[model samples]
Target: MFRLSSLIGCTVLFLISCGTSKKSFVMPSAENISAVKFLGEYDIPYNLLYKNTVVGGLSGIDYDKKNDCYYFICDDRSDNNPARFYKAKIFITPHGIDSAVFTDTRSLLQPDNTVYPNKKQDRLHVPDPEAIRYSPVLNQLIWSSEGERIVKEKDTILANPAVTSIGLDGSFKHSFELPANLTMHATENGPRQNGVLEGMSFANNYKTLFVNVEEPLYEDGPRADITENNAFIRILKFDVASRKNTAQYAYKLEPVAYPANPANAFKINGIPDILNIGTDKFLVIERSFSTGRAACTIRVFITDLHNATDIKNIASLKGNSSFVPATKKLLLNMDDLGIYIDNVEGVTFGPVLPNGHKTLVFVADNNFEKAEKAQLLLFEITE
Candidate 1:
């Protein structure tokens, strides 16, 4: 079954400015700026067996215009099943989403044309995928993995994170050359454990690819907390043809908004998804969760790289520096749209609506938990 909700009281304002620069970013008034209105939501039952495979943990999603189908990537690390992605057909009209039907499932393959083995079967660390996107230039799907970080008795093993490409059939294609600084290191510096790559998107021209980590690197700063201090994450731009990182910028993450629980009072906030709106503009999703709540806080923002400092060579963003983070404008908060919120990790521009407005879609990762259900939320971008 599905649920429908009417959009209401969706007004929000975000003042974006660099603390070190004179430039300021102010979103146009709500009357002028386009609003993403909630449409409907559908759930994929937890532990629903399909073709002998459990259907859950859908973390990332992309729309394939050519096939008129949506590709959802499961965050499963070959624990319950081989790492895989599902092809789903989502029927939509001007009113709302009609139905979301799972069509097929494909297992991700390695360069050797073999499916990824379970962690117990192979001693090597398996990938923890967080984001995926359809690349028009390569005619394939590009995905990002948050590599593992394990500290042992005598040594610290850091598996380098990666952005890889694969065909619709799940055949291995190739991988982008990541910058050395972004790699996991045994030293105290570099990307933190589980804070590696997460959000990914391609530019409108399809010539440049953008990716972002979930949290700050060890050298940058600390993860977000319940204070005024905001953590910093990096966004890297890659040249598609050259497969090299071209530019890097600092992104500031807001602190956790919810109060912590006394028993298990840890809070987490990070960037999970990014979408290209224009040449240098993007829509980024910042999701924050506390230990005790079934609901998390999700916010959408519009940002641009104009006048932002390029820190590709600089080692750290702390101390005295002139680097300016990207300016952001808050678009909408999912909680204000009168719909249930979960772990929203994926966002993409969907097909055009009957009213000629652009459509935006979000998918949640249920973590295969019986208490949660894989959800797909649809919205219309009204300009």
Candidate 2:
């Protein structure tokens, strides 16, 4: 009887120990991050040519930890060259960003084992590459393309946005089955032109995937302007193993930063990229550009889905307020930095610094224009 009683006591103690361990384990979150200090900026010369391809339109960037290098996707749309990504070695020091050297370039392949053709060649498959992330778990690189949506009186070229996995060598792997709402339609019912699948990141130890749109869908609401403050964009969650979008949440965008030059030019504000800091928490980049403005307004915000309602099943968010959107807190604004910020579109967490603080990097899209510059900015995270 004593032996049985001792055994039972040991089992109870073990159970209590397990419970304590579980309770003590705290998940890492954006709350732990306090602020970020600007480190330095590096600008790649305009119209730099490498491997016979123009090195511009660097809209998306990701760092490969194992290789200690960076991959930048060029949103050339096959106009200058075949749709491609470039690998480079960026040198970062305590003082600031030293320089970036191009190492290699690879053409992103299609399922047909051919590179994406330009619009004049094949209007249906012209890829507008935007965001990219390197997955150590899958040992592959995942990229997003905001597919074309052109509707002419006689010619309609519509291609669905895509999130595809590719081998490290840039070979096509597979694609995730996107939700139905992402479909492109000629009418005003689906994603707006050049607004789908702007940014993506892996979360939950690469088990879950998150991709966001550049703007609100037609059914969601009207685009962000000087008057509207209720434009809602969707952040989609995908189960990596299943390669399917599982859930989605709505995120409201701020109004346009500034009015257009002629009061009706081009003005826009939307999420351009996002990075996962912890469980359901992300660092989002909201880029605002107004016509006739010399530079863009770039802001970094940290958001979480702790109390956000899942809006995956909801058809439209035009006038709906029944669901709570993700909670957001501003982290940084480039305007306050007193520096000219370009069209900054990409954000990613870099390697830790010697002081043990984390590093964050942002890259700008030059649009292959001589007027704009391909810029890279570095920041050190403060706890």
Candidate 3:
């Protein structure tokens, strides 16, 4: 069992896995234990009045150590505003986060130097940005979009998901060639609607990049239901120099821990953020939302692909298979922490704490709703 502590306005949940060792699986131990301490929380006003433009839907965040600033990607999709990202300054101290103030904003533009058109402007799907990461190797930002699926006149139109790089000035840099299995198709064996790429990170000294889909591919498995056996998401690692996926593995997601209504069982689970903490190891954020309750359950886990089978060439993971999925250990569960959980969609390593421990920051996607707020939560990690 994990330990829990009550702070001034937040609760801290220290999670640790407990199990005996098996032949194929390694049991978790205190030596592998990591703890997350609640530092502080802040919320940017919804439709925050800034520069005469509304700012909300902060879905992804990345830290720029070079400038000591943070970049937040808004999944606005040109509806409320053009697809854009914001540059902000976050003040931190040994105690916790002091303040986060927006400094400027940049709109993502097409190669033609024009802003992406909204859905209303064009029947075709626009970029539904989800996750963004600052690339130290390229000195730019890499972002992922969960492209939409449209059906018109009995013809299915698939807007393929994309991982694109952009300069700090918001100019397009380059786009990576994704595997064919990731592209959406009209058949039942393709990616489900809005279930394409989401979380992304760079590892191996920024030579290799990793991207994950939100749900199982159409042929890999069925979407998560109320059962304990949830979907298995695909995690792909790309070699920057080669411009191709070098390896891939499967990550099993847990079923919705809490259902807003038992009868309806409207539950959702997906990967929203990922951070490279070590070689072939990552800190992954699994966000589960239960509709009607207006509440979310967010958990952080450390996963390693040490001996996992690479499924990059396999189109389906549902049939009889002998492949091993990545091993994972739970790190933190925000629900047990007693913090108000929202749609947490972003996570990144922040500046080192005064005590030398690394800081972890999470940001929520408010969907630009007036009733919801763009919240930023800070946590300090101890090994």
Candidate 4:
């Protein structure tokens, strides 16, 4: 979910299929996983104030194994406060997520050491912060910003999307060099607003990074609708050391789960966050929401790039059949849990349970809505 109003891989193997040819495949150990057990949920009181800042739009989250804590990027866009992230400690018991306490908050600073301003202050630089990841190797937090694209206003503003890393204290560290395609344009020739650069994660033992756009770019194809089952989005890979995009691959997005009310209300289905589980493999989240629906439909899937074609140089993917998209398999659907699922945008591996089983945690962005509740859900990976 991008708007404030909308309450929104591991083991690669090579195989020889034909006598004279070789085909690559990824068979992650997670494929053998038997079930996902829902533990419990904790709601961060609506608009809970911490460090004098209103905390609600928690869009992206990452587990800091070294510090035994978590870092969450707020999709605040510097509206209520400067674009920022929070360090928090979420205590998880066998029964559920017991409690959560905010430890610290830091404003993401620009190269000039100033906090990002709101659109009203600087329309060009106002950032729509979406996803964040903690790089233990660099001891920094990397985040993505869906920069402004104001076409309706008299003054045109086009702040290209960005991916940047910051020091532990939120000081500027480095800005990634993005490709030309990610730049926002005046016409519908590039990324759609609020649909670019949403999910990111560290892969290949922190040597490589992966980031994906929420929806397809204009040149790629059409936005996902109730009947568009083959909508495609690009996932960009980066060499962490160089901080440049190395390759890009297409991933198919599932169709919109439900039809919008009144036949034209707001509705969408797109990826919000991702997690690296093994080499070249990841866990992806597909969130779908439509107007007049009581809750969002969230699906967790596993995908890998072993057989996927790199589309970095391909200008368009519409009706293109020369490339193969990453293979995906459904793992879990939030609707099956029988719980009220909000706009879930983040997912990460949590601390191991006392029973020795690994854990998975998900967080929801409330969009700071008074009627909505910010949630933290826990689950056990029973293999």
Candidate 5:
């Protein structure tokens, strides 16, 4: 019976249906994703920028460009109660890369290998971690544990791959295991279907370890998964001295017109842009959560890894290409790199750019935030 202009038009139609129902993570008009001109696109120009960040942001990043400095980790628990134990290392510059002043603290996750043996076995106690890398002849430190929960659909959360050797002063040497189920399938459609694995890279001396699996999550319009297939790129290969699984390659992310169906492709989800680019060549980072753009594609393989038989297979390789007419064509198209990420979880490759070619980096793992949003997007692969 109230008629104050019909109670302000029913409170303006209840605030326009609560603002179209809480979906504003930035879908502006669908294909309007931009973030690759930095100060030119994102505008972080202040003195050219570069100050701190030794271990304040990193959800998943792995770099061992023969040793320039990189082996970071930050999945969460500094205050959430796992107690607090993040890994670290940083200080490489061309323009952006900082995180190294760590006199030495010691907390690289450890619950008990010896339970702390003497307090240095690379320490321990981790969960829901993202990614990290480094192997030098078996020096150790090749991890991955992309674990997350809360599903109404398909559920089968399986992610486990670890190995530590710890030394540099933090201590911890020789931890093992990485080969059995091999993990990272993505979906069959049930529990909480998955496209999970978390990016990683290492082949020069890390024996062999290249894993990246994130691609799954759609609304049907980002290009519509081309049409709709399944969503793939398992590409596993772990030996690291008999850890097993010498080969296993799965590639399915060739979206074009749609209906590609591995099951209906489109779920690299995010965070995995690995790189090795040499012998069997490797440099994978294809992000396009529906045309938002983010690709570093380049994977030429014929693996034999000396002999490991299971080269699984991933032959023809070469980077991504397509950005018609140039000028970002419509706010989305990648050549070598593109960053304006909302969900770019991890990528690694460093050292060798003086006309030699090689220095690509990327990290984004905000899942430590649940819905997702923790960034560390860096780039370089020129020459």
Candidate 6:
């Protein structure tokens, strides 16, 4: 039983509400966080170079300083009947993109390149992946595939994404079955096109797995009007031992109206990634899409997620600008970027520079476009 002093109106209380499985679940509290600053940009730049892009897009990103270079994954595949996975090296800077080169160019396809052993039926045109991370401590690149197909139809389980560990050479070293309940999510708006759980980042010194929900399944009601409740982001912390999500932190990406959209036309967005921006402070990439437009901008919130376990209503994020960074500077549109890809998928923190300042890095999912480019943007922050 947890009692919270209402920061909004009357004193609201929070109690353990039972879950679908008869489990006790307590909702976090409502918080009034203030807006923050960008702290300027960390200077790292990168570009995308690939032989084929029928693979479509790249979603998640991770940096492995152990090898002195940054790594990323692409869910889109070559246009062949049997598609394959692609990867690249991202070098980024604050100014813009520098270069992105695809390496370990291989195929997830089998002999005759016609079988996807991961699934039994329904040939995959290409896998729509949303998450990817490299664990230097583990010497392995961990990634999550948001899109997977099944022939039996009955085998449909909200999300059955796989967590594969790839070697330095882009070879599969270890593959683990991700707990469906903890990793995968159901797309709500389009009943036919369901977007599964895709965001992946490692935190707690690489001890806990932070998995976030992009959007909810059919539960989103209707996409009639641009509403606040539609924006959702859940951060799931996994305990390697129990192999279960130790903590589930869910929050609504609150909408803020800036000079860009005077009618308050813009909706709130969720965290594409989270990091320890400062010594004790954390920064979450709060993002959202613009209506009738292809571009989107994401703001930064330097809040204490450890203390944020109390945020209740997602719509309540309005007026919390003190905790969020400046708007319209990070991006003009979500789908459109200064680079080839507007879909910037993953983000992670790199090692501390020799000067003692920390480096913040972001990676873009190329959507595997021959013309489009995958980018890795790096920034040096003075905390």
Q: Residues 1-383, candidate 6, lDDT per residue (tens digit)?
A: 44354542342222222223343322111122232213222222223234643433546666656555655555643333233444555544444335555564544432233424333343342344567776655666666655543324455444355555565555566555344343333332222133345667665555556665554333322221244443434455665434455554444555532223444564434455554332223456655555444444555555445444522223222334322321212322322324323445666665455665555666655444444445455655553
lDDT of 6 at 308: 45
**1-383: candidate 2 lDDT, tens digit per residue:** 37988999999999999988752222123446889999999999998999999999999999876678999999999999999999999999987899999999999999877999998998888899999988777789899999878888998878999999998778999998989999999888789998989988888877788999999999999999987669999999999899998888999898888998999899899899988888788999999999989899998888998799999999999999799999999999999888889999898777778988878889999999888979999999997
Q: Superpose all Cα atoms of candidate 2 onto the true structure and report the RMSD in Å to 1 decimal.
A: 5.5
Candidate 3 global TM-score: 0.88
lDDT of model number 2: 0.89
For candidate 5, write residues 321-373 as lDDT tens digits: 11111010122233334434555555555454344434445554444343444
Model 2 misplaced stretches (Cα beyond 4 Å)? 1-31
Q: How many residue pairs clash in each candidate?
A: 0, 0, 0, 3, 49, 47
True-structure RMSD, every candidate = 13.9, 5.5, 14.1, 12.5, 19.6, 14.1
Writing each residue's lDDT as its tens digit, candidate 3 over 149-171 gives 87667766678888888898889
In angstroms, the error of model 6 at 10 is 66
Worst 10 residues of 5 by lDDT: 320-329
Error of 2 at 191 (Å): 0.4
Residues 1-383 of candidate 1: C-alpha lDDT, one tens digit per residue:
33332222222111223334433322111223367888888887779888878998888888876678888888898998998888889998877788888899998888887988766886466878788888655678888888888878885656789888899889999889999888787776899888889898888466788999989998888888878675889999999787799999988998886877873587889998988887578888999988888887899988888779889998888763678999988998887976679989998878877777778889988999988768888888876
Model 1 residue pairs with clashes? none
Model 6 quality (TM-score):
0.60
lDDT of 4 at 350: 90
Model 3 clashes, total count: 0
lDDT of 4 by residue, 164-210 (tens): 98998889999999999999998988899889989998887677889
Q: Which ten residues in a row have the lowest lDDT in candidate 2?
A: 22-31
What are the clashing pairs of model 2?
none
CA lDDT of every candidate: 0.82, 0.89, 0.81, 0.88, 0.43, 0.47
